[model samples]
Target: MNILITGSTGMVGKNLINHNNAKEYSISGPSSKEINLLDKSKILDWLAKNPTDLIIHCAGLVGGIQANINNQSGFLFNNLQMGINLIDAAYKSGIRNFINLGSSCIYPKNISNEIDESMLLSGKLEETNEGYAIAKISVAKYCQFLSEKGFNYKTIIPCNIYGKYDDFSETGSHMIPGVIARMHKAKINNDNYIEIWGDGKARREFMYAEDLADAIWFCVKNIKQIPKFINVGIGEDFSIKDYYQTISEIVGFKGEFKFNRTKPVGMKRKLICSKIINQLGWMPKFSLNKGISYTYNYYTKEIQN
Candidate 1:
């Protein structure tokens, strides 16, 4: 099988390429410079010229809570265009096997317990990432609609993912990377204390990038065996304060933490139920402590350079 993976330079895409040990498949990961996702003409042209059998659409306009809140329209328009164009072009080019990467944020905001796949679009979405959530929902709906026409496509909704190669910008990175960068910077700068958003009570589920990569590989090989949409995660969660303490310890940050009561904490408890994917014999390997340690080391050595 000849597979094409978009967002090759991203955390998940990079890990996917690295963890793929199968000897039978040929994988190609195109950089943004080589294939601009927003340009539908370029996507179609590339697909026509390059014969690909499978496509793992990982490219999108992704960012953290602050970034999402700041660039709501950009998140919506850019992500929507990318998914719509890539999948449609692939389908037109005779590519049947497709795996679309989605976020758990598509679940309703009022979720107080374990989130199920059936609960999608059941209610309102988190205000902080409503635009991005809407974009993901559109992609899933598109794939679901196309499946009725004999398209072998499905969407995988993964919980909060973090690891090496993640965006660490203060304004653009997700929760884990943002916390790592801030604590690392504060430790080096010898700051007395660091401030965190919200009261540190909300809980979240996290999956390592390498684990997600492995799961994607599993799905591609077993695409025909899986359902139209599935959730891939560790099936566990922790509080914000626990994350702060853990990250601080991993980054060697001794500074005190100050919780900002005014800042927004998107969801009270956003935990996904990975029972379906688990039943398929796929599971995450990295524990939170181990993943944080490995990611922090990577950040200090590679990203800090």
Candidate 2:
């Protein structure tokens, strides 16, 4: 099968392209300067280059809460344009098997702590990333509409992804990567304290990016009637305060972290109630501590090597 992935340079995409265990498939992404999702015409032209059988829509404008707040227009516009353009082009080109990547933030704020797929669009989203959330929701709707029209597309929403090849760059990284960078710097400098956002009361669910890649390939290979949409997560819950302690331990930063109440602490916690995928006999294998350790080791060696 010929496969294409978008957002190939980002954390999730980088991990997926490298971790995909599927052997007999051809894979391509944006880094080759082949497909720029921002330009609709470019999307069409790129799609024509290959009679691809499948597309992993992993491309989008994504970042931490700060980036979302500081660049709402760019976040919302670019991501919306990319999703609509690519999905429509895939449909027009007769590529039925498309995967629309989504985020857990699309779920409503009042969603039960352990959120479910059915809870989407049931309430308002967290305001900090509402624009980004709406774009993801649109993709979900687009996939469902296409499926109803007899197209075979699927949208899989993942929560708090982390692991190898994360963007440690100052502007692009998310919470996990951000924390890793901060804690690592602190460790190197022998600092005594790290600063975190809000009251450190918020909870989040995290999955290693490689484990998510595994789940994606599993879905592609095993499921025929891809439930239109599904949730991907570790089915575990953790708080930011606990996370800081964990990262501190992993990086050996014996410092205390101050909770900055002024900053936004997205949702209290977002644990995807992925009973559907779990019932299909899939579960995340990496614990947060171990995943953090490996990620730290990666950046450490990246600096050393």
Candidate 3:
């Protein structure tokens, strides 16, 4: 099974490649020179030329809350184009077995504990990431529509994935990497306190990237009885304040946290339930502490250089 992955350098894509099973899988991680996603001609041409059996789309302009707020147009346009182009090309070229990865941000902001797959598009999305959320919704629905039309494709909505290969840059990284970077920088600079956004009251679900990869492989291998769209998460959540405290402790950031009430937190609470995926015998195995520590080490060792 030769799998085509677009965003090989991203956090999730990096974990998907670095896993031991990935070495066994016939996977191709083409650099930008191979196929620019926005270049429709290039993407279609590449699909027609390359004989790929599967396409695990991991590309797009992804960022955290602040990044989303700053670059709404880029997020919406890039993600929409990437999703539309990849799926259209793959479908037209007669390639099936597609796996589209979407964010939990697609869920409505007010969704309470254990968000089901059906709750999508039911309410207003978090304003901070509304553009990104809308783009993700389109992608997910695109896959779902194709699935309904008898395409052998699936979409996995993972919640707040973080691990090795994550962007440690403060401005563009997600919560986990961003927090780790902040903690590391604070520790190095001997800063007194760390600033958190939106009062640190919101809750979120997180899954290790490696665990997400495991779940992806599990779904790919067992596509039988799979839903058109499924939620991939740890089935648990933690408040942002608690998450910051944990990361601070792991990175040895001995400082107080200052919450800025003026900033806008994306979702009040978002955690996806894996009842559908779990019933098929797939599960994620990483505690918040362990994943944060592993990711912190990776960022400090590989990225901080």
Candidate 4:
């Protein structure tokens, strides 16, 4: 099979391309320079020349809460445009199999229970990341609408992901990567403390990027049996403080954490239930400690140096 994966340079895309099973298929991961997802013509032209059998749409403008709040318009417009342009172009190119990656942010905020795939758009999204969430929701719905029309396009909503190739910049990193970066720096500099956003009470579910890649490959092999929209996650969550503490232990940061209550924490909790994917004989293999340790190793070797 011939596969085309977007966001090839990003963490998830890189993991997907590097998966052990990826050797079984011919994979083409186009950088934006090769196929700009925001431009329909470019995507169509690339598809025409490439003749792909499956497209895994993983490209997007994603960031942490502060970044999301600061650039709502960019997040909304860029993500929405990329999704629409790619899916439409794929359809036009007669490509039927597509895997649209969605986020846990698409679920409603402040829910006291684990978010299932059915609860998408059930209520208001978290204010901090609402714009990005809205764009993701729109694109997932577009995939569903097309699926109803006899297309094999499916959306896989994964929880927060962090691993190799993740953005660890101060301004753009997600919770795990940001925390890993900060803790590692603190450990290296012998800093006494590090600042955490909010009260460090917000709960989040994160899966290893490589684990998500495994799930995607499983879905690719069994695309016909996959649901229109499915949730892929570790089926558990931890407090922000738990993540910080875990990373601190891995990075050997024996320091105090100061929580700034004034900062915004997007959702009180955002744990997705992976019952469907689990029942379908797919589950994440990495534990939080193991995943974070691997990610920290990657950071020190790849990003820090």
Best by TM-score: 4
Stretches of candidate 3 above 4 Å error? none
Candidate 2 per-residue lDDT over residues 29-74, each given as its tens digit? 7663677777778888888877789898888888888889898888
lDDT of 1 by residue, 1-305 (tens): 88899988888888888884534678889888788889888998988888899999999989988889999999999999999989888888888889999999999996888998999999998999999999999999999888878988899999999998899887789999999999999999999999988999999999889999889888987898888889999999999999999999888899899999999989999999999989999999999999999999999899998
Cα distance off (Å), candidate 4, residue 301: 1.5
lDDT of each: 0.91, 0.84, 0.86, 0.91
Clash count in backbone of candidate 2 = 4
Shift in Å, residue 154, candidate 4: 0.2
Model 3 has an lDDT value of 0.86
Clashes of each: 0, 4, 0, 0
Query: How well is each residue in 1-305 modelled by candidate 3, as lDDT tens digits?
Result: 88998899777788888887787678888887889998778988987777899999888898888888888888999999989988988888888789999888888878776788898888888888888889989988988888887887888889888898887786888888888887888899999998998899899888889999898878778765788888898888999999999998899999899999988887788888889888888878899899988988888788877
lDDT by residue (91-207, candidate 4, tens digit) is 889899999999988888889898888898789888888889899999999999999999999999999999988999999998899888878878889999999888998898889
The total number of steric clashes, by the backbone 3 Å criterion, in model 3 comes to 0
